[model samples]
Target: MINPLGIVITVLYYKIAEKIKKISIFSKIPPIVIAGVMLIATLEIFDIDYDIYNESAKYLTIILIPATIALGYPIYKNIELLKKNKRIIYTGFIIAAVIAILTTYVVAKMCNTEFIVIESMLPKSVTAPMAVEISKGIGAIPELTACIVALTGIFGGVFGHKILKLIKVKSDVAIGLSIGAASHVIGTARCIEEKRESQVVMASVALVIVGIITAIIIPLFIYLIK
Candidate 1:
């Protein structure tokens, strides 16, 4: 049986998130987080089965691919800027990737975390889909990788700008790279909301580059380390 209530709940939560975002103080809270909390509360109150809800709402997840592809428009519009800053962009991407991997490894080691746990965390900065694939290739838990990736996105989307500002990162490219490299899609959404086309382009570009690099390099790195 089709669950229309699941779809209705998703739509209503999104609208509520939009409304919450319009308020002054709550404006900084990421809409996804608001929608997530609302969804959980609603599910509990209504005693909805998550499995059934997810099955009915699976179409929403499918739309993410096209939405990601549509980011090409912004990248095309700022092609000149991307070309002009190719050196800086690639440098930032490599450095960010290295730092992400190293930090995860070191922290996991310090905690005496399992090797598989460390491996899963290696791709934590990338988007969930890529991270999950990378986790699988490296023999890590995909579900754990997805959870870490989501938490990273939520944290970065909420505090990324403030962190960049605190560090005096005034350049749009640098800000975009930092946020996108650390947070993925959620961070890109935050950039889009800022209405800065250049930031949006660079963030999207960084995300794509990081995803590719993580997918390729992380597997090789894991092999070498093993």
Candidate 2:
């Protein structure tokens, strides 16, 4: 039942991907993305069932609970930042959630995208765990929601800073919120890569607030539109 080899392979894939991530051209690509791709390739080559892999590696998912709680550290360190700009920060999260959902919905409708896809993508900007639950609650495909969320995060993490700089927006809070609201934890991880504690702290908070805000509105919006 406990397949140690699956655990070893999973960790090894991620470790190798992390090393690959150090390359300048590959720097923007997150290790998880690379590791996930490689793992999929390996599984297909070996004809391994995903169930076997997931059963062994499910323990890793538990670590996310503590990792999420640890984000409170940055918030504690930067509590003053929130205290000083609670209005702006809260407003930003709300605006970001509303815009992300509205735009996705409108565009998908215009494009005649599938109902299932639109529902799944409605929460694409949210973090995986919350996004998955939202997808289910809204009667969407959780698997598709997870994939779209990952891609959205990757896109935001890779280009968020570059796009901000291109526009001459240098404020860490703005940058963090933009990336975090758009991409969730992966974009926040990009903030970590930049070593800007200001960015990281704000980003971590952005995803949480934005996630909550999105979760509340999306189901209501779906019900209204459908």
Candidate 3:
């Protein structure tokens, strides 16, 4: 039987984390990161195996599919904007994907990373499911790929706005595309917080586009290089 206790504990932690995020000092920190840290510490203190926690928490992961589909509402509401800028959106997505892949490969090579590590890191910019699949196809570790994907999302969620400001990225479309392409759902969440409908729409669109492109291109590229 599935442990109902685990689900209860997980939901409680998330609720507490959300409240904590509303505090002035913790406002900037993403709730997922906070909850993750809290969960890790709690597990360590109790000497709980991560695999056991994962098994207990599997239902939450399943909810993510429907949650992702729900993001379409914002995009659908802003359909006209997306249609108006389809060309630019597609162009920017392609460019961002290319740069992301090349930079990951180049940095891994420069650091003298192992072949498997390079392959795993190559899909770090996309969503976790796609990243894991791409990593598996390229003979990389799916677990490692998932880790990199999560880190990318967290880092982008936390610091993406500051980076964009530093680079003087003024366009909403550009901001949305860059964050979504680089950080996936976490970045899209950040974009939604901006309280701008257009940005949310563009971010959602960019995320879907980038995920699709990464899923299609990375495997082919790996095959060619091998």
Ranking by lDDT: 2, 1, 3
What TM-score against the true fold does each predicted structure earn? 0.77, 0.84, 0.82
List pairs with backbone clashes in candidate 2.
none
Per residue, candidate 2 scores C-alpha lDDT tens digits across 55-138 of 888777657557655655756776777787889888998999999999999999999999999999999898887887788888
Which candidate achieves the best TM-score against the true structure? 2
The residue-level lDDT of candidate 1 at 28 comes to 63
Residue range 84-189, candidate 1, lDDT tens digits: 8688788898888888887888888999998987888899889776777678778899868877888889789989999999989998889888899989888988
Candidate 2 residue 216 Cα shift, in angstroms, is 1.9
Positional deviation of 110 in candidate 1, in angstroms?
1.8
- CA lDDT, candidate 2, residue 19: 100
Error of 3 at 83 (Å): 1.8
C-alpha lDDT score of every prediction, in listed order: 0.82, 0.87, 0.82
Instruction: Give candidate 1's error at residue 62 in angstroms.
Output: 2.8
Give the total clashing residue pairs for model 2: 0
Q: CA RMSD for every model?
A: 3.3, 2.6, 2.8
Candidate 2: what lDDT?
0.87
